[model samples]
Target: MPAQPIHTNRLILIPFTLKITKTLMAGDIGILQKLGLQLTPYWPDQEAIDTFPKIIHNLEKVTEPTGFESYMVVHRNSMSVIGDAGFKGLPNDDGEVDIGYAIITQAQKNGYGLEVAKGLASWAFKQPSVKAITARCLLDNKPSARVLEKLGMQQVSTDVELIRWKMMNPAHEQDTIDC
Candidate 1:
Protein backbone atom coordinates (compact mmCIF):
# COMPACT_ATOMS: atom_id res chain seq x y z
CA MET A 1 0.00 0.00 0.00
CA PRO A 2 1.05 3.57 -0.64
CA ALA A 3 1.99 5.79 2.24
CA GLN A 4 -0.81 7.70 3.93
CA PRO A 5 -0.80 11.37 4.88
CA ILE A 6 0.35 12.05 8.42
CA HIS A 7 -1.92 14.43 10.28
CA THR A 8 -0.79 16.39 13.28
CA ASN A 9 -2.92 18.69 15.43
CA ARG A 10 -2.47 21.65 13.06
CA LEU A 11 -0.79 20.27 10.00
CA ILE A 12 -1.08 17.46 7.48
CA LEU A 13 2.08 16.10 5.96
CA ILE A 14 1.37 14.74 2.51
CA PRO A 15 4.04 12.48 1.14
CA PHE A 16 5.47 13.74 -2.11
CA THR A 17 4.74 11.58 -5.12
CA LEU A 18 6.52 11.74 -8.42
CA LYS A 19 3.50 13.41 -9.98
CA ILE A 20 3.34 16.10 -7.32
CA THR A 21 7.04 16.86 -7.66
CA LYS A 22 6.84 16.95 -11.43
CA THR A 23 3.80 19.18 -11.38
CA LEU A 24 5.40 21.60 -8.97
CA MET A 25 8.63 21.70 -10.94
CA ALA A 26 6.68 22.32 -14.10
CA GLY A 27 5.46 25.55 -12.53
CA ASP A 28 1.93 24.31 -12.55
CA ILE A 29 -0.29 25.58 -9.74
CA GLY A 30 -3.02 23.10 -10.55
CA ILE A 31 -1.47 20.53 -8.27
CA LEU A 32 -2.39 22.72 -5.35
CA GLN A 33 -5.96 22.89 -6.53
CA LYS A 34 -6.10 19.16 -6.98
CA LEU A 35 -4.75 18.58 -3.52
CA GLY A 36 -7.23 21.10 -2.08
CA LEU A 37 -4.43 23.15 -0.64
CA GLN A 38 -4.01 26.90 -0.55
CA LEU A 39 -0.92 28.66 -1.86
CA THR A 40 1.14 30.74 0.48
CA PRO A 41 2.86 33.70 -1.06
CA TYR A 42 6.03 32.79 0.74
CA TRP A 43 6.02 29.13 -0.31
CA PRO A 44 7.60 27.62 -3.38
CA ASP A 45 10.43 29.89 -2.44
CA GLN A 46 13.87 29.40 -3.96
CA GLU A 47 14.90 26.84 -1.38
CA ALA A 48 11.75 24.80 -1.85
CA ILE A 49 12.05 24.97 -5.63
CA ASP A 50 15.63 23.80 -5.49
CA THR A 51 14.67 20.80 -3.38
CA PHE A 52 12.06 19.61 -5.88
CA PRO A 53 14.62 18.08 -8.22
CA LYS A 54 16.06 16.08 -5.36
CA ILE A 55 12.61 14.98 -4.18
CA ILE A 56 11.72 14.05 -7.73
CA HIS A 57 14.90 12.08 -8.20
CA ASN A 58 14.41 10.19 -4.96
CA LEU A 59 10.73 9.54 -5.62
CA GLU A 60 11.54 8.13 -9.04
CA LYS A 61 13.36 5.24 -7.38
CA VAL A 62 10.15 3.65 -6.10
CA THR A 63 6.75 2.97 -7.59
CA GLU A 64 5.08 4.78 -4.68
CA PRO A 65 5.95 6.93 -1.72
CA THR A 66 7.55 4.86 1.03
CA GLY A 67 6.79 7.46 3.70
CA PHE A 68 10.53 7.86 4.00
CA GLU A 69 10.96 10.62 1.42
CA SER A 70 9.88 14.24 1.52
CA TYR A 71 6.40 15.50 2.32
CA MET A 72 4.50 18.68 1.66
CA VAL A 73 3.74 20.46 4.92
CA VAL A 74 0.24 21.89 4.82
CA HIS A 75 -1.45 23.97 7.46
CA ARG A 76 -4.64 22.31 8.69
CA ASN A 77 -6.84 25.36 9.10
CA SER A 78 -5.64 27.41 6.18
CA MET A 79 -4.86 24.37 4.05
CA SER A 80 -1.90 26.32 2.80
CA VAL A 81 1.34 24.77 1.76
CA ILE A 82 3.49 26.06 4.60
CA GLY A 83 6.66 24.14 3.75
CA ASP A 84 8.20 20.70 3.39
CA ALA A 85 9.49 18.08 5.83
CA GLY A 86 10.40 14.39 5.96
CA PHE A 87 13.05 11.72 6.17
CA LYS A 88 15.94 11.87 3.72
CA GLY A 89 15.32 8.25 2.78
CA LEU A 90 14.75 4.82 4.26
CA PRO A 91 16.64 3.82 7.36
CA ASN A 92 20.29 3.06 6.70
CA ASP A 93 21.93 -0.26 7.55
CA ASP A 94 22.23 0.98 11.09
CA GLY A 95 18.45 1.46 11.19
CA GLU A 96 18.79 5.19 11.41
CA VAL A 97 16.91 7.72 9.28
CA ASP A 98 17.75 11.39 8.85
CA ILE A 99 15.05 14.04 8.92
CA GLY A 100 14.95 17.56 7.50
CA TYR A 101 12.41 20.33 7.29
CA ALA A 102 11.92 23.86 6.00
CA ILE A 103 9.16 26.25 6.94
CA ILE A 104 8.45 29.32 4.90
CA THR A 105 9.40 32.67 6.44
CA GLN A 106 5.74 33.49 6.89
CA ALA A 107 5.18 30.32 8.89
CA GLN A 108 8.27 30.45 11.07
CA LYS A 109 8.32 30.93 14.87
CA ASN A 110 4.81 29.55 15.27
CA GLY A 111 5.86 26.18 16.77
CA TYR A 112 5.23 24.45 13.46
CA GLY A 113 8.80 23.31 13.16
CA LEU A 114 8.69 21.43 16.42
CA GLU A 115 5.30 20.06 15.54
CA VAL A 116 6.53 18.67 12.25
CA ALA A 117 9.67 17.21 13.72
CA LYS A 118 7.81 15.63 16.59
CA GLY A 119 5.26 14.14 14.27
CA LEU A 120 7.94 12.71 11.98
CA ALA A 121 9.86 11.21 14.85
CA SER A 122 6.74 9.71 16.33
CA TRP A 123 5.82 8.08 13.05
CA ALA A 124 9.32 6.81 12.46
CA PHE A 125 9.59 5.18 15.86
CA LYS A 126 6.50 3.14 15.13
CA GLN A 127 8.21 1.52 12.15
CA PRO A 128 10.03 -1.64 13.15
CA SER A 129 12.94 -0.89 10.86
CA VAL A 130 13.56 2.52 12.40
CA LYS A 131 15.62 2.31 15.55
CA ALA A 132 16.77 5.90 15.56
CA ILE A 133 16.17 9.21 13.81
CA THR A 134 18.98 11.64 13.11
CA ALA A 135 19.11 15.27 12.08
CA ARG A 136 21.58 18.04 11.37
CA CYS A 137 21.54 21.79 11.35
CA LEU A 138 24.11 24.39 10.48
CA LEU A 139 26.17 25.29 13.52
CA ASP A 140 24.90 28.85 13.32
CA ASN A 141 21.27 27.98 12.75
CA LYS A 142 20.04 28.45 16.27
CA PRO A 143 16.38 28.23 15.35
CA SER A 144 16.77 24.83 13.74
CA ALA A 145 18.87 23.68 16.67
CA ARG A 146 16.14 24.76 19.04
CA VAL A 147 13.58 22.78 17.12
CA LEU A 148 15.66 19.62 17.24
CA GLU A 149 16.38 20.13 20.91
CA LYS A 150 12.71 20.70 21.65
CA LEU A 151 12.05 17.35 20.03
CA GLY A 152 14.37 15.78 22.62
CA MET A 153 17.12 14.91 20.15
CA GLN A 154 20.62 14.92 21.55
CA GLN A 155 23.60 16.56 19.95
CA VAL A 156 25.53 13.50 18.87
CA SER A 157 28.38 15.39 17.32
CA THR A 158 29.43 18.60 15.60
CA ASP A 159 31.73 19.76 12.90
CA VAL A 160 32.91 23.11 11.67
CA GLU A 161 29.74 23.68 9.70
CA LEU A 162 27.04 21.45 11.16
CA ILE A 163 25.80 19.90 14.39
CA ARG A 164 24.42 16.39 14.18
CA TRP A 165 21.62 15.23 16.43
CA LYS A 166 20.05 11.85 17.13
CA MET A 167 17.02 10.43 18.96
CA MET A 168 16.87 6.74 19.65
CA ASN A 169 13.53 4.97 19.64
CA PRO A 170 12.36 4.44 23.19
CA ALA A 171 10.56 1.26 22.26
CA HIS A 172 13.67 -0.09 20.65
CA GLU A 173 15.59 0.59 23.80
CA GLN A 174 12.91 -1.21 25.77
CA ASP A 175 13.13 -4.17 23.44
CA THR A 176 16.87 -4.32 23.97
CA ILE A 177 16.36 -4.45 27.73
CA ASP A 178 13.60 -7.05 27.46
CA CYS A 179 15.70 -9.20 25.17
Candidate 2:
Protein backbone atom coordinates (compact mmCIF):
# COMPACT_ATOMS: atom_id res chain seq x y z
CA MET A 1 0.00 0.00 0.00
CA PRO A 2 2.96 2.30 -0.19
CA ALA A 3 2.19 5.39 -2.29
CA GLN A 4 -1.50 4.56 -1.98
CA PRO A 5 -2.10 8.29 -1.29
CA ILE A 6 -2.44 10.24 1.95
CA HIS A 7 -5.39 12.10 3.47
CA THR A 8 -6.19 14.21 6.46
CA ASN A 9 -9.64 14.89 7.87
CA ARG A 10 -10.00 18.16 5.99
CA LEU A 11 -7.72 17.64 3.01
CA ILE A 12 -6.65 15.07 0.48
CA LEU A 13 -3.05 14.70 -0.76
CA ILE A 14 -3.34 13.21 -4.19
CA PRO A 15 -1.73 13.41 -7.59
CA PHE A 16 -2.11 16.83 -9.14
CA THR A 17 -5.07 16.99 -11.45
CA LEU A 18 -4.84 18.45 -14.92
CA LYS A 19 -8.17 20.15 -14.23
CA ILE A 20 -6.41 22.23 -11.59
CA THR A 21 -4.44 24.04 -14.28
CA LYS A 22 -7.56 25.77 -15.58
CA THR A 23 -9.23 26.30 -12.22
CA LEU A 24 -6.08 27.84 -10.82
CA MET A 25 -5.22 29.95 -13.83
CA ALA A 26 -8.64 31.24 -14.85
CA GLY A 27 -9.68 34.92 -14.50
CA ASP A 28 -6.19 36.40 -14.25
CA ILE A 29 -2.96 36.72 -16.17
CA GLY A 30 -2.00 33.41 -14.59
CA ILE A 31 -2.45 31.24 -11.51
CA LEU A 32 0.38 32.87 -9.63
CA GLN A 33 -1.06 36.25 -10.57
CA LYS A 34 -4.39 35.26 -9.01
CA LEU A 35 -2.67 33.80 -5.97
CA GLY A 36 -0.50 36.88 -5.54
CA LEU A 37 -3.60 39.06 -5.64
CA GLN A 38 -5.35 36.79 -3.16
CA LEU A 39 -2.45 36.88 -0.70
CA THR A 40 -1.29 40.47 -1.01
CA PRO A 41 -3.17 41.82 2.03
CA TYR A 42 -1.93 39.35 4.59
CA TRP A 43 0.71 40.28 7.15
CA PRO A 44 4.20 39.48 5.86
CA ASP A 45 2.43 38.99 2.58
CA GLN A 46 3.97 36.30 0.39
CA GLU A 47 3.24 38.00 -2.90
CA ALA A 48 6.53 36.59 -4.09
CA ILE A 49 5.36 33.04 -3.57
CA ASP A 50 2.03 33.79 -5.23
CA THR A 51 3.53 34.48 -8.61
CA PHE A 52 1.25 32.20 -10.70
CA PRO A 53 3.71 31.46 -13.44
CA LYS A 54 6.42 30.42 -11.01
CA ILE A 55 4.08 28.24 -9.03
CA ILE A 56 2.89 26.51 -12.18
CA HIS A 57 6.45 26.21 -13.37
CA ASN A 58 7.57 24.72 -10.08
CA LEU A 59 4.62 22.32 -10.10
CA GLU A 60 5.72 21.02 -13.47
CA LYS A 61 9.29 20.71 -12.28
CA VAL A 62 8.17 18.62 -9.31
CA THR A 63 6.18 16.31 -11.54
CA GLU A 64 8.96 15.72 -14.01
CA PRO A 65 11.68 14.97 -11.50
CA THR A 66 12.45 11.27 -11.63
CA GLY A 67 13.67 11.21 -8.06
CA PHE A 68 10.74 12.75 -6.22
CA GLU A 69 6.99 13.29 -6.09
CA SER A 70 4.58 16.13 -5.26
CA TYR A 71 0.92 16.53 -4.51
CA MET A 72 -1.64 19.26 -4.59
CA VAL A 73 -3.31 19.72 -1.22
CA VAL A 74 -7.00 19.61 -2.06
CA HIS A 75 -9.65 20.50 0.47
CA ARG A 76 -11.99 17.58 0.10
CA ASN A 77 -15.14 19.17 1.45
CA SER A 78 -14.71 22.27 -0.65
CA MET A 79 -13.33 20.36 -3.63
CA SER A 80 -10.76 23.08 -4.00
CA VAL A 81 -7.00 23.18 -4.43
CA ILE A 82 -5.89 25.24 -1.47
CA GLY A 83 -2.15 24.66 -1.65
CA ASP A 84 0.84 22.54 -2.57
CA ALA A 85 3.13 20.20 -0.60
CA GLY A 86 5.85 17.77 -1.55
CA PHE A 87 9.18 16.05 -1.00
CA LYS A 88 12.15 17.22 -3.07
CA GLY A 89 15.74 16.02 -3.65
CA LEU A 90 14.87 12.39 -3.48
CA PRO A 91 17.02 9.74 -5.19
CA ASN A 92 20.06 11.72 -4.32
CA ASP A 93 23.01 9.91 -2.81
CA ASP A 94 22.49 11.96 0.30
CA GLY A 95 19.41 10.02 1.40
CA GLU A 96 17.67 13.28 2.24
CA VAL A 97 14.98 15.44 0.75
CA ASP A 98 13.37 18.78 1.47
CA ILE A 99 9.67 19.06 2.21
CA GLY A 100 7.76 22.18 1.22
CA TYR A 101 4.23 23.53 1.50
CA ALA A 102 2.28 26.73 0.91
CA ILE A 103 -1.34 27.04 1.94
CA ILE A 104 -3.50 29.83 0.54
CA THR A 105 -3.83 32.85 2.82
CA GLN A 106 -7.44 32.15 3.77
CA ALA A 107 -6.50 28.64 4.80
CA GLN A 108 -4.01 29.79 7.39
CA LYS A 109 -4.55 29.62 11.21
CA ASN A 110 -6.60 26.45 10.97
CA GLY A 111 -4.82 23.11 11.72
CA TYR A 112 -4.81 22.01 8.08
CA GLY A 113 -1.18 22.96 7.52
CA LEU A 114 0.06 20.91 10.43
CA GLU A 115 -2.22 18.02 9.53
CA VAL A 116 -1.23 17.87 5.90
CA ALA A 117 2.43 18.26 6.81
CA LYS A 118 2.36 15.31 9.17
CA GLY A 119 0.40 13.24 6.67
CA LEU A 120 2.84 13.94 3.87
CA ALA A 121 5.88 13.19 6.03
CA SER A 122 4.35 9.94 7.21
CA TRP A 123 3.64 9.02 3.62
CA ALA A 124 7.20 9.84 2.64
CA PHE A 125 8.55 7.63 5.40
CA LYS A 126 6.55 4.74 4.03
CA GLN A 127 8.58 4.80 0.86
CA PRO A 128 11.26 2.15 1.05
CA SER A 129 13.97 4.37 -0.35
CA VAL A 130 13.29 7.45 1.71
CA LYS A 131 15.59 7.79 4.72
CA ALA A 132 14.88 11.29 5.88
CA ILE A 133 12.79 14.39 5.12
CA THR A 134 13.81 17.96 5.82
CA ALA A 135 12.22 21.38 5.84
CA ARG A 136 13.29 24.97 6.35
CA CYS A 137 11.37 28.14 7.12
CA LEU A 138 12.12 31.78 7.46
CA LEU A 139 13.11 32.51 11.06
CA ASP A 140 10.14 34.85 11.37
CA ASN A 141 7.64 32.25 10.21
CA LYS A 142 6.67 30.77 13.56
CA PRO A 143 3.61 29.13 12.06
CA SER A 144 5.61 27.10 9.55
CA ALA A 145 8.08 26.09 12.26
CA ARG A 146 5.21 24.99 14.46
CA VAL A 147 3.94 22.71 11.71
CA LEU A 148 7.38 21.18 11.33
CA GLU A 149 7.58 20.59 15.07
CA LYS A 150 4.14 18.97 15.03
CA LEU A 151 5.45 16.54 12.46
CA GLY A 152 8.32 15.61 14.82
CA MET A 153 11.16 17.37 13.03
CA GLN A 154 14.00 18.47 15.25
CA GLN A 155 15.49 21.88 14.70
CA VAL A 156 19.03 21.38 13.52
CA SER A 157 20.20 24.91 12.80
CA THR A 158 19.30 28.52 12.18
CA ASP A 159 20.95 31.10 10.02
CA VAL A 160 19.87 34.63 9.25
CA GLU A 161 16.49 34.01 7.68
CA LEU A 162 16.23 30.23 7.84
CA ILE A 163 15.60 27.53 10.42
CA ARG A 164 16.38 24.01 9.28
CA TRP A 165 14.58 20.91 10.55
CA LYS A 166 14.87 17.22 9.82
CA MET A 167 12.79 14.08 10.35
CA MET A 168 14.39 10.70 9.96
CA ASN A 169 12.49 7.64 8.87
CA PRO A 170 11.04 5.50 11.62
CA ALA A 171 13.22 2.64 10.51
CA HIS A 172 16.19 4.73 11.54
CA GLU A 173 14.99 4.87 15.14
CA GLN A 174 18.12 3.19 16.44
CA ASP A 175 20.29 5.99 15.08
CA THR A 176 18.19 8.65 16.71
CA ILE A 177 18.11 6.70 19.96
CA ASP A 178 21.84 6.31 19.91
CA CYS A 179 22.44 10.00 19.40
Candidate 3:
Protein backbone atom coordinates (compact mmCIF):
# COMPACT_ATOMS: atom_id res chain seq x y z
CA MET A 1 0.00 0.00 0.00
CA PRO A 2 1.08 3.56 -0.54
CA ALA A 3 2.19 5.57 2.47
CA GLN A 4 -0.98 6.94 4.04
CA PRO A 5 -0.03 10.29 5.47
CA ILE A 6 -1.30 10.88 9.01
CA HIS A 7 -3.21 14.11 9.55
CA THR A 8 -4.25 16.20 12.54
CA ASN A 9 -6.07 19.48 13.02
CA ARG A 10 -2.90 21.46 12.32
CA LEU A 11 -0.22 19.00 11.23
CA ILE A 12 0.53 16.34 8.66
CA LEU A 13 2.87 13.43 9.44
CA ILE A 14 4.49 11.71 6.49
CA PRO A 15 7.48 9.43 6.22
CA PHE A 16 10.84 10.84 5.24
CA THR A 17 11.45 10.05 1.58
CA LEU A 18 14.91 9.17 0.25
CA LYS A 19 15.03 12.19 -2.03
CA ILE A 20 14.25 14.62 0.73
CA THR A 21 16.61 12.83 3.05
CA LYS A 22 19.36 13.34 0.51
CA THR A 23 18.46 16.98 0.23
CA LEU A 24 18.58 17.33 3.98
CA MET A 25 22.02 15.73 4.01
CA ALA A 26 23.15 18.22 1.42
CA GLY A 27 21.88 21.05 3.65
CA ASP A 28 19.48 22.23 0.98
CA ILE A 29 16.52 22.27 3.35
CA GLY A 30 14.58 24.42 0.91
CA ILE A 31 13.56 21.15 -0.76
CA LEU A 32 10.99 20.67 1.98
CA GLN A 33 8.88 22.94 -0.19
CA LYS A 34 7.81 19.76 -1.95
CA LEU A 35 5.86 18.95 1.18
CA GLY A 36 4.65 22.52 1.55
CA LEU A 37 6.94 22.90 4.57
CA GLN A 38 8.92 26.06 5.22
CA LEU A 39 11.06 24.89 8.10
CA THR A 40 13.06 27.15 10.35
CA PRO A 41 16.81 27.36 9.90
CA TYR A 42 17.17 25.45 13.14
CA TRP A 43 15.87 22.32 11.50
CA PRO A 44 18.02 19.33 10.47
CA ASP A 45 19.68 19.58 13.85
CA GLN A 46 22.92 17.67 14.38
CA GLU A 47 21.25 14.77 16.10
CA ALA A 48 18.55 14.32 13.45
CA ILE A 49 21.10 14.63 10.70
CA ASP A 50 23.52 12.27 12.42
CA THR A 51 20.78 9.67 12.77
CA PHE A 52 19.46 10.03 9.24
CA PRO A 53 21.30 7.03 7.89
CA LYS A 54 19.86 4.69 10.52
CA ILE A 55 16.37 6.11 10.05
CA ILE A 56 16.69 5.70 6.31
CA HIS A 57 17.82 2.14 6.88
CA ASN A 58 14.89 1.45 9.17
CA LEU A 59 12.50 2.83 6.58
CA GLU A 60 14.02 0.52 3.99
CA LYS A 61 13.78 -2.50 6.26
CA VAL A 62 10.17 -2.34 7.42
CA THR A 63 8.84 -5.90 7.67
CA GLU A 64 5.13 -5.16 7.72
CA PRO A 65 3.22 -4.14 4.62
CA THR A 66 1.87 -1.13 6.55
CA GLY A 67 3.17 0.27 9.83
CA PHE A 68 5.07 3.12 11.39
CA GLU A 69 8.17 4.90 10.05
CA SER A 70 9.79 8.18 11.03
CA TYR A 71 7.71 11.12 9.87
CA MET A 72 8.35 14.78 9.27
CA VAL A 73 5.94 16.95 11.22
CA VAL A 74 4.56 19.57 8.89
CA HIS A 75 2.45 22.43 10.19
CA ARG A 76 -0.60 22.86 7.98
CA ASN A 77 -1.29 26.54 8.52
CA SER A 78 2.28 27.79 8.34
CA MET A 79 3.30 25.09 5.84
CA SER A 80 6.52 24.64 7.78
CA VAL A 81 8.14 21.43 8.88
CA ILE A 82 8.19 21.68 12.67
CA GLY A 83 9.69 18.31 13.63
CA ASP A 84 10.07 14.56 13.05
CA ALA A 85 8.13 11.74 14.69
CA GLY A 86 6.62 8.22 14.49
CA PHE A 87 7.50 4.73 15.64
CA LYS A 88 11.14 3.73 15.44
CA GLY A 89 10.43 0.44 13.69
CA LEU A 90 8.03 -2.48 13.33
CA PRO A 91 6.21 -3.85 16.33
CA ASN A 92 7.91 -6.65 18.24
CA ASP A 93 6.37 -10.10 18.70
CA ASP A 94 4.74 -8.85 21.90
CA GLY A 95 3.22 -6.04 19.82
CA GLU A 96 5.30 -3.18 21.09
CA VAL A 97 7.24 -0.49 19.25
CA ASP A 98 9.36 2.48 20.25
CA ILE A 99 8.53 6.06 19.26
CA GLY A 100 10.90 8.94 18.52
CA TYR A 101 10.06 12.57 17.95
CA ALA A 102 11.39 16.08 18.23
CA ILE A 103 10.42 19.67 17.51
CA ILE A 104 12.64 22.65 16.79
CA THR A 105 13.78 24.52 19.90
CA GLN A 106 12.12 27.57 18.42
CA ALA A 107 8.82 25.70 18.22
CA GLN A 108 9.13 23.88 21.53
CA LYS A 109 6.39 24.23 24.17
CA ASN A 110 3.90 25.32 21.54
CA GLY A 111 2.22 21.86 21.59
CA TYR A 112 3.36 20.61 18.19
CA GLY A 113 5.10 17.64 19.80
CA LEU A 114 1.97 16.71 21.73
CA GLU A 115 -0.26 16.91 18.71
CA VAL A 116 2.13 14.88 16.61
CA ALA A 117 2.48 12.24 19.33
CA LYS A 118 -1.28 12.08 19.80
CA GLY A 119 -1.89 11.62 16.10
CA LEU A 120 0.94 9.13 15.55
CA ALA A 121 0.23 7.05 18.65
CA SER A 122 -3.49 6.81 17.84
CA TRP A 123 -2.66 5.85 14.28
CA ALA A 124 -0.21 3.20 15.45
CA PHE A 125 -2.68 1.72 17.95
CA LYS A 126 -5.24 1.41 15.19
CA GLN A 127 -2.87 -0.50 12.95
CA PRO A 128 -2.68 -4.28 12.89
CA SER A 129 -0.96 -6.11 15.77
CA VAL A 130 0.01 -3.00 17.69
CA LYS A 131 -0.50 -3.38 21.48
CA ALA A 132 1.68 -0.67 23.00
CA ILE A 133 4.03 2.22 22.30
CA THR A 134 7.12 3.25 24.26
CA ALA A 135 9.17 6.40 24.46
CA ARG A 136 12.30 7.66 26.21
CA CYS A 137 13.52 11.14 26.97
CA LEU A 138 16.49 12.71 28.64
CA LEU A 139 16.02 13.46 32.33
CA ASP A 140 16.25 17.14 31.61
CA ASN A 141 13.55 17.08 28.95
CA LYS A 142 10.56 17.79 31.16
CA PRO A 143 8.53 19.11 28.26
CA SER A 144 9.01 15.89 26.33
CA ALA A 145 8.04 13.81 29.32
CA ARG A 146 4.88 15.89 29.66
CA VAL A 147 4.02 15.13 26.07
CA LEU A 148 4.14 11.46 26.94
CA GLU A 149 2.08 12.04 30.05
CA LYS A 150 -0.50 13.93 28.05
CA LEU A 151 -0.53 11.03 25.61
CA GLY A 152 -1.68 8.75 28.41
CA MET A 153 1.74 7.20 28.87
CA GLN A 154 2.92 6.21 32.33
CA GLN A 155 6.43 6.21 33.66
CA VAL A 156 7.56 2.64 33.40
CA SER A 157 11.27 2.96 34.20
CA THR A 158 14.21 5.26 34.64
CA ASP A 159 18.00 5.21 34.43
CA VAL A 160 20.85 7.53 35.10
CA GLU A 161 20.29 9.67 32.04
CA LEU A 162 16.75 9.03 30.79
CA ILE A 163 13.27 8.00 31.75
CA ARG A 164 11.07 5.51 29.93
CA TRP A 165 7.33 5.81 29.38
CA LYS A 166 4.78 3.48 27.86
CA MET A 167 1.10 3.37 27.03
CA MET A 168 -0.59 0.07 26.47
CA ASN A 169 -3.42 -0.17 24.03
CA PRO A 170 -6.52 0.56 26.11
CA ALA A 171 -8.33 -2.08 24.10
CA HIS A 172 -5.98 -4.71 25.44
CA GLU A 173 -4.77 -3.45 28.84
CA GLN A 174 -6.83 -2.95 32.02
CA ASP A 175 -4.85 0.08 33.15
CA THR A 176 -5.95 3.48 31.89
CA ILE A 177 -3.95 6.53 30.90
CA ASP A 178 -5.02 10.06 31.80
CA CYS A 179 -4.71 11.56 28.29
Backbone clashes under 3 angstroms, per model: 0, 4, 1
lDDT of 2 by residue, 1-179 (tens): 12334788888875433344435455322443333222223312244235434445544655443324556566777655577677654545656778888787887798888988888777777767777888999999999999899889999999999999988888876766898
TM-score of each: 0.95, 0.71, 0.88
Full-model lDDT for every candidate: 0.91, 0.66, 0.80
CA lDDT, candidate 2, residue 3 = 35
Clashes of 1: 0
Model 3, which residues run further than 4 Å from truth?
63-67, 174-179
lDDT of 3 by residue, 1-179 (tens): 74678999989887777667767877888788766677677677876798678667776675432446778788888877777887777898888889988887777878899999999888888876788999999999888988999999999999999999988987767433433
Across residues 22-116, which tens digit of lDDT does each residue of candidate 1 receive?
98899986789788988666778888899999898878888899999999999999999999999888899989999999999988999999999
* Top-lDDT candidate index: 1
Pairwise lDDT winner, candidates 2 and 3: 3
